[model samples]
Target: MGDTGMPRAFIPRPSPCAPPSPISVFATIDSPPWTLAMSTYGYENCVAGTFYGFTKTEFNPGDTFSLQWGAIDDGATPLNITLGRAGGYIIDEIIVGAQFTKTSALYQLVVDDTANCTLEEFSWAIPDDFNTTDPQYQIGLFNASVLLGADGVPLFGWQAWNPDFYVRPVSSTTTTDASSTTSTVAATATGGNTTTTTSATSLSTFSASPTSSSVSDDSTSNSETIGIGVGVGVGVAALAAVLLGAFYLRRRRKKAQTPSQGLGGVRQQYIQELPATEKRPPMHELAG
Candidate 1:
């Protein structure tokens, strides 16, 4: 028998390992695919590090994955970056590293798909009123949409500790008068005696050498005396005529009655002709 470990026929074919040509190994490691994007703004000159316990591939709640700086204004002054809750970590707080002035700030949210080996990133801006003490600023693993709340739902409840100052509204009134020469006068009168008077004097000449003078006085007094006089002119002829007419009428009546008295017989005849009830009608007849 030939030696057990020895080759029977030494057939040396061309050596396959004769200095293999340089083969470049191209790496095709597929990176995780991005599913969602989240971002924030307003942070400038912030240090780059693992914030909110989020690694380069992890996300946390309330995470500002990416960051951008905004201008200095009454709104959020500093931009913040942190892990988003989409991945699993509940963000309980936010840490702002630097202040920002002028320029928009931006941030992004990123997540890693462990099963599919995919990475997701979403972008967003820090809100205008974003502040550490702002009520809207919340932490913990909560849905962004849910945290923002719906139409009827309440938003965050954190109150800003810093007080904001504002100017108070002012009101004014104005009054104007049209006439310049108009005057207002107020007077009070008291006690027993008070007098008010107005006076005016004037002179006029209708012809040469004409002269005129006048005086007027109005007075009030406690006691006053007034005198009145009447003058009568007597006429002897008028008086005598009235007396003579009176005397004539008396004489005529006397003469007429004398005849009547002397003629008693005629009188008696006239009287006998008269009726006893002639002077008055009977009571029943008078009533009718």
Candidate 2:
């Protein structure tokens, strides 16, 4: 061991490279099915050639690049960018911001997480322009499978379905009022008294009177006719009774007179026939 604590060997410090600047991708969703706005921030870095097992590869500039939210086999169009490629490359440095812009499409999105599950999975589609007035630019992602990164991990956490816009009334109110009024004219005899009340309001008006006299008259011609009919019925019944009594009396007189008359005639005939025999057949006279 050299002299205790004799200034340790001077180790030259390594120079630090500048950290990569964060990139931002702004996205706004104006469509019906989705309404989302976000800014994705990230950094770009070049991978080592040895990592790809290719020693002769060269980086190419001015080539096309794309960053998709879903897996390569998901059948979704990748969010793309046009760039130049220089030479051969494995993983090129295409700086992507941490934030991204997104918006909804016209058609609604319905995502199901589990088969037959009532809970619905939520998703949003992105449009090219945020200020586009035409609704056609809206991109709709319906029942889309969750997006996955190269590492096979979900890009975003779980999200619930929600509407983008809201509606409100211009004005509203609630109030009510009702009232009424009354007028009366009265001419009364010596101790008569009368009173009236009236009220008026925006909704309605009312009026009342303590006393009122209004009569309707109907003629009694029908009653007079009915009385005449009753009188005629009584007269007819009396006439029928008198006629029946006369007939009964005549019949009784005829029956009683006939008996007496018949008896008288028979007696007369018998006396006329028995006169001679009666003179000779006087028994007491003959025996004397």
lDDT of 1 by residue, 80-167 (tens): 2222222222233233222321221211223222321111121332333333332222222111211222233332211111111111
Candidate 2, 249: how far from true, in Å? 0.9
Lowest summed-lDDT stretch of 10 residues in model 1? 165-174
Q: Which stretches of candidate 2 lie over 4 Å from their true place?
A: 1-219, 275-288
Q: Which regions of candidate 1 deviate over 4 angstroms?
A: 1-116, 134-288
Task: Name the best candidate (by lDDT).
Answer: 1
Minimal lDDT window, size 10, model 2: 172-181
Looking at candidate 1, what is the lDDT of residue 177? 25
Best by TM-score: 2
lDDT of candidate 2 over 1-288, digit per residue (tens): 111211121212112242222222333223343332111112112111101111222111221111222211222222211111112111211112111223223112122233211111122222233222321211111111222121232212111111112111212111111111122122222123332211122213322221221111123566677899999999999999999999999999999999999999999999999756434644465564
TM-score per candidate: 0.14, 0.24
Q: Distance (Å) between predicted and true CA of 150, model 1?
A: 15
- lDDT of each candidate versus the true structure: 0.28, 0.27
